[model samples]
Target: MPYLGLIVLVVMIAALIDIVSSDDALVRGLPRWAWLLLVIVLPLVGSVVWFVAGRPVAGFSGRVGRDRPGQASAMGFPEYDHPGRFVPQDPEADAAFLKQVRERAEAQRRQGEIERRRRVERERGQ
Candidate 1:
């Protein structure tokens, strides 16, 4: 009986932590604040409801399906799941990306210079 009470307490605490730490948008059904109230008001039942409905489903290896920029994997560490998640794994690809960025910056700088010169010319002509 004592052990049963302890188990319930543990489960309730775990559920509370999960609810508080979970992303607001990911929680389904009720709003996060309402869910918090439910859990606080009805520990065991609320915990069960949270697990069944509110909790975000863990992906393969416990990661969330939607990957946010700089968000860690479900394993609680960073993993480069997509090519854009981190720097290019291949050296050639990294170099190519850097070259493209440099070219873009140079083009913008040249365009700005041209615009500034045109503005100056227009002002002088006026």
Candidate 2:
């Protein structure tokens, strides 16, 4: 009986913490206040229902489960799953991208100088 009481107390506390800490968007089936009320009114049953239905499913990695097959993990944006996400995870790839940007800027500077020189020559001729 004492163990049962302890279990119920733990479950009630866990439910309250979960309700308070969970994002409104992630909670399902009912509003947070309603869930809180339910948990308070019927500790064991409400806590069970909240865990089974209201709370979002998370895996061992702490990533929310995908809603469908082939969907991205909820921890990141869907764009992160795309091939062109542009996350430079590798140092070599990051360096290469920086180099390309530098090269493009240098080219643009040279083109700007040439255009300025041509404009000056035209003015001189006039």
Quick one: best lDDT, which candidate?
2
Candidate 1 wrong stretches, greater than 4 Å: 60-126
Q: What does candidate 1's lDDT look like per residue over 1-126, in tens digits?
A: 769878888988999999898877667788889888998898899999999999865542423344575664323323333322333346476556666776898999999999999999999999
Q: What is the TM-score (0 to 1) of candidate 2?
A: 0.47
Query: Which candidate gets the maximum TM-score versus the true structure?
Result: 1
TM-score of each: 0.48, 0.47
Looking at model 1, report the run of 10 residues with the lowest lDDT sum.
74-83
Q: In model 2, which residue pairs have backbone atoms overlapping below 3 Å?
A: none
For all predictions, the C-alpha RMSD in Å is: 7.7, 11.4
Q: Could you give candidate 2's per-residue lDDT for residues 14-85 as a string of tens digits?
A: 999999987665578999999999999999999999999998555334334445557763223343343223
